[model samples]
Target chain A: MSGAFYLATRYMRRHRGKTAVMVAAVTLTLLLPLAVTVLVRAYDRQLGERAAATPMVVGAAGNRYDLVLQALYFRAGRVGTVPASLADDAERDGMAVGIPLHVRYTAQDAPVVGTDLAEYAAFRGLTVAEGDWPRMLGQAVLGHDAAERLGLGPGDTLTTDQQNLYNLARNMPLRLRVVGVLAPTHSPDDRAVFVSLRTCWLIGGHGHGHAPEIHDDEALHRAARLAVEVTEDNVDSFHFHGDMDALPLSAVIVLPDSDKSRTILTARFNQATPGVQALDPPTVMDELMGLVFRVKRFFDANFALVLLATGLLLGLVVTLSLKLRTAERRTLHLLGCGRWLIVQTQAIELGLVLGLSAALACGLAGALTLLAPRWLGV
Target chain B: MIELTDVRFRYDASASGAFELRVDRLALGAGSRTAVVGPSGSGKTTLLHLIAGILTPVQGRVVVNQEELGGLPDAQRRRARLRSMGMVFQDIQLLDYLSVRDNILLPYRLGGGLVLDREAKDRAESLANRVGLGDKLGRAIDKLSQGERQRVAICRALIARPELLLADEPTSALDADTARATLNLVFELAEETGTTLVVLTHDPSVLERFDRVVHVDGGGVS
Candidate 1:
């Protein structure tokens, strides 16, 4: 066995060029499958972790995926805003409501979100990396990635666009100070800036020239304009910045009071609602993953075909090589070599080629895993 | 020592029974030099092959020392051939990829018994010098002329200093001078090592140098 290995090594060295080419081909074949397997598994694990961390998400009635993307990921899309009465309705039924007043704006490509401090604990589950969460109307808290990208920390001021940053059609910029930085979290929360929901209303009310400057106690009492009113007395008094009949909101996140209340509310809303839909997040995510898996299966099938063809080509090459060396083989036989020895030599040669190719494939797979994301813009 | 008894062999059953060769009995003792000469299709090469254990006779008892070649298993026969017998073929069969020295080391590698020991290497160098391939030991076999390659083969056959040496038409492709020198070197080396020597050829010049001559006709010893 050792002698066979030695001979195999010698033979490989003698034909190093051909062996290298074989190794490269094998490496590429092996690497594609290995990298895909690892990447897909890792991505699945990350997605599962994120989903499990949030028990349930309530969003506006529309495309479930669009609602989830806007509510959870802060991505640009159609949004629906439910009345503040929904929070009271949920709390009355015994559930905690973390209402987020989303304001779509960006500073240097990072989304800035305006929501109450409860949103930090509710939606993001964030912990302070430095300083404290924003308390003042003009102050902001940065997510890990947002801070890292903008090189901002607590006490550093950042500017926000007046309109959606992703859509440059409306260029509205707002200057705000960074009050805190959040710890790293591998979720959508890693890329957002958080502020009090009142700040969002302030920005929206500013468009209507409704900035109130209180000079004295008399003026302060009158300066208290109703921006968002949930109480019965002010419910009809809250002013809508846009057409009251066709108000636009990206999405509204809901939290039901109890399991019973969740079913009752869902039934009631589905029966009488207009321009609203309730969706189970996990179901929508599963449908999306099914589409992804279908695409993956297509790629896997194509790769399998290529792998099979390469195997056949390898077999053909080896057979032809042995046939071409028949005269040399016969000479060795006449020199007292047994038929088994010649066969064993050929087997060892093939094994070496395969082993080297597998090793190269592993190396190529690792390289691809490390480099592909950036190149493919992932 | 080598012995053959009732060695009846046929190339094919379709040929005439006159094509058969029967050597009732023949014994070549240690330190003996025997030459075989015959016309074409006379089975000289077959006899050499049978003696070298390269072929099995249909009915025969070929014994080298106490081990019977016809009775031994295939693996043992190969081992015995590699360790104890040396052969120089009619066509020089040196490995084209390896240098002359590496080719000489083939038997030791195949047997897995000995490294290139100092004495064996020295013998190889000396034999190469004797065959006028002193400076060509490092050269690949393909680069050498036919006569040069034959000299390399002769050196390889003597490298392990086997107990038996077989030469088949070693000088068939050489000039007269080179042939005479090659035969002289082979005989001198065999005598010096006190090894049994067997030569198979149609040329009569080699017969004059051997202790005994065996002639074959119609595949039978005559």
Candidate 2:
């Protein structure tokens, strides 16, 4: 046994260059799946965290994926709204209602959302990293990523488009003052632009030539009469004097009061209502993750197969290399080294290379995982 | 001391046409020097291998230092070889990776922290000096000439100061003068250490130097 160990060390030292190369190859092979596994686990963890944070989400019923994306991720294209009467009813039933006044207008391809102050506290779990929340209709607050991307901080201003870029008709832009910047949240809230619900109504009104003139208090009352009305009874009504139909709202977020209220509200809206549906957020997200996991499993299995093949190939190559050194083996045998000892020496050398590679690969994978979110800006 | 009685060995399985060995009886006492002389196909190397515990004769009762070699297990045979025997092969099988000094120290390392005696190291160094390898201790095996590597092998064989020393064609690769000097040094060292020496060689010159000579032919002692 001692002879075998000494021989193993001798063989390793004799072919240091080849052994190093084999170690590197094994390390890289082990590193690939380790890194991929870490990234997949982190991404899965992030998704799970996001899901658990939200108690529920309310959106349109048609295409639940699209609805959740618009409501949670704020990606736009949801064209549904619940009546203000429902929000009033939820609040009356002692529910903490969040009214999402969504407006899908973009400045330089980043979304600008118009929502109430309760939105900052309700679904987002937001905290003020700097400055204060929006105080008035035209005042705005920026999510952490939004602030970074738009190069806007507190005391700066942003001008939002009256419609999305593909709108055939153009209208005036609403000038908004940045009041607060949100901290990093690792959720969709980090990329949102928040403003007062009234600002959304004002932007909606501006497309109808109802924008108030900026001539101080004298012009304000005069333009107030000409502005489009956003009454609870006729929230969808738009004056046709300008591009009123191009008002930029893509969806509205609703919070139901209780289990009974949610059931009543969803039944009332979807069964009898004209052009809207209510969706459950958790169910939609589950369906989305199921699809993602299925695809990921397929790729993971393929990656595992490839790694197994590579390991087998490496083993075969080492075996062939040892066989090719038969003359050396014979010489050692004549020097009183038994055949079993020589074979064991070869095995030990291979084991050492593989063991070291596995350890190094695990470390590299862990480092990549810890740095991934920062690098990808997720 | 080494003893072999009516040894028969076969490299093949067949009853007939098998490589057979028949030695009626032979004994080499402690501190004695003996030579085995034979031509090609004479089983001289096989006899040495058997005595060194490298091979087990199919039919034989061999004993080394009162331990029955034929009845011992493989592991015991290896242990006996490691503790009591030293070998010099014809091709001078020095490990290519290690330096001359490390190769000479291989036996000590193999015995698991049994420190090589200071006296043994001194003796090895002195023997290497006598063989003109005093300056090549740190040189890699492949860097040394055939004769210098053979000299290193001789030093390694004597480093353990074993009770039994087996040399198979130790002077095959050396010039006449160098071979004579190496043989003289080996015999002198064995005498000083009281080691029983067994030399297997095809050359007749080696036969004249040993105290006893045995000629093998057709796998039988003649």
Best by TM-score: 2
lDDT of 2 at A223: 46
- Candidate 1 residues B125-217, lDDT tens each? 788878788898888777898888888887777777789999998888888887888788888888888879999877775677898898877
CA lDDT of each candidate?
0.70, 0.72
- Once fitted onto the true fold, the runs of candidate 2 whose alpha carbons sit more than 4 angstroms away are A1-38, A55-62, A74-96, A101-114, A134-181, A190-246, A272-275, A325-347, A361-378, B13-17, B29-35, B97-100, B111-148, B171-194, B202-213
Compare the candidates by DockQ and give the number of the best one: 1
The sequence of per-residue lDDT tens digits that candidate 2 reaches over residues B1-222 is 899988888778644467777888999888889999888777898898889777898887899999889898876777677678888988777778888887887767554233667876777677777778888877888898777888788778877768999999888888888788778878887888899999987778567778899889988886
Q: Alpha-carbon error at A354 in model 1, in Å?
A: 3.6
What's each prediction's clash count? Answer: 10, 1
lDDT for model 1: 0.70
The runs of at least 3 residues in candidate 1 whose Cα sits more than 4 Å from the true structure, single-residue gaps closed, are A69-94, A99-118, A121-123, A128-169, A172-182, A188-249, A252-258, A268-272, A294-304, A355-378, B13-29, B32-42, B90-102, B112-156, B168-192, B199-218
Tell me how far the alpha carbon of residue A103 in candidate 1 is from the true structure, in angstroms, after superposition: 8.9
**Model 1 lDDT per residue over A70-148, tens place:** 6666776656665444444434445445354464556667776766577545565689899897765657788887888
The residue-level lDDT of candidate 1 at B151 comes to 80
lDDT for A116 in candidate 2 is: 62
